[model samples]
Each structure stands twice: as C-alpha cells, then as structure tokens.
Target: MLVVYTTTLFMISLLIIDYSTYVLEYPHSFKYNMVKNK
Candidate 1:
C-alpha cells in the first residue's frame, strides 16, 4: 500500500512538472485552448 501510494504521488508530480513545462513553452496556445474549451 505504501509503494502504491508513493508511485501514484510520483506520477502526479511528474505530470504536474510536465504540464507546467508545456504551459511555459506555449502560454498563448494553452490560453487559446482554454478559451476554446469553454
């Protein structure tokens, strides 16, 4: 159970890091998509 919890947390952190990097690289497109989604 501890291993599973650690693995899930690690994956979530990696995803957050990746997403932030993407947003930093494409702020305009990200914003555009957000507006379009609405």
Candidate 2:
C-alpha cells in the first residue's frame, strides 16, 4: 500500500512538471515567432 501511494505521487509530480513546461514553452515559442516575423 505504501509503495502504491508513493508511485502515484511520483507519477503525479512528473505529470505536473511536463504540463508546466509545455504551458511555459508554448507561449514563449509563440512570442518568439511573432518577434521573428516582425
């Protein structure tokens, strides 16, 4: 039971990191494109 709980917590943290990076990178890329076009 403890092992399962720890695994689930680890998975959740990984997902949060992935999602945060994606969210941050997407807007940064979009802004970069706009600047490049200008």
Candidate 3:
C-alpha cells in the first residue's frame, strides 16, 4: 500500500511539473514574440 501511494504521488507531481513548465513557457514565448515584432 505504501509503495502504491508513493508512486501515485510521484506521478501526480510529475504531471504538475510538466503542466507548470508548459503553462509558464507558453506566455513567455508569446510575449517574446510580441516584443520581437515591435
């Protein structure tokens, strides 16, 4: 049971980190593009 719980927690955190990276990078890329065009 403990092993299963830890594995689930690790997977959840990995997903969260991936989501955070994508979310943070998306706006940064858009902003960078806007600045470049200006």
The estimated TM-scores of all candidates read 0.67, 0.89, 0.82
RMSD of each: 6.4, 0.7, 1.0
Top TM-score prediction, candidate number:
2
| Residue 5 of model 1, lDDT score | 100
Error of 1 at 15 (Å): 0.3
lDDT of 3 at 9: 100
What's the candidate order when arranged by decreasing TM-score? 2, 3, 1
1 or 2, greater by TM-score: 2
Q: Which residue pairs in model 3 clash with each other?
A: none
Residue pairs clashing, model 2? none
Scored by Cα lDDT, where does model 1 land?
0.95
Candidate 3 local accuracy as lDDT?
0.99
Task: Write candidate 2's Cα lDDT for 1-38 as tens digits.
Answer: 99999999999999999999999999999999999999
- Superposed model 2: Cα runs more than 4 Å off: none
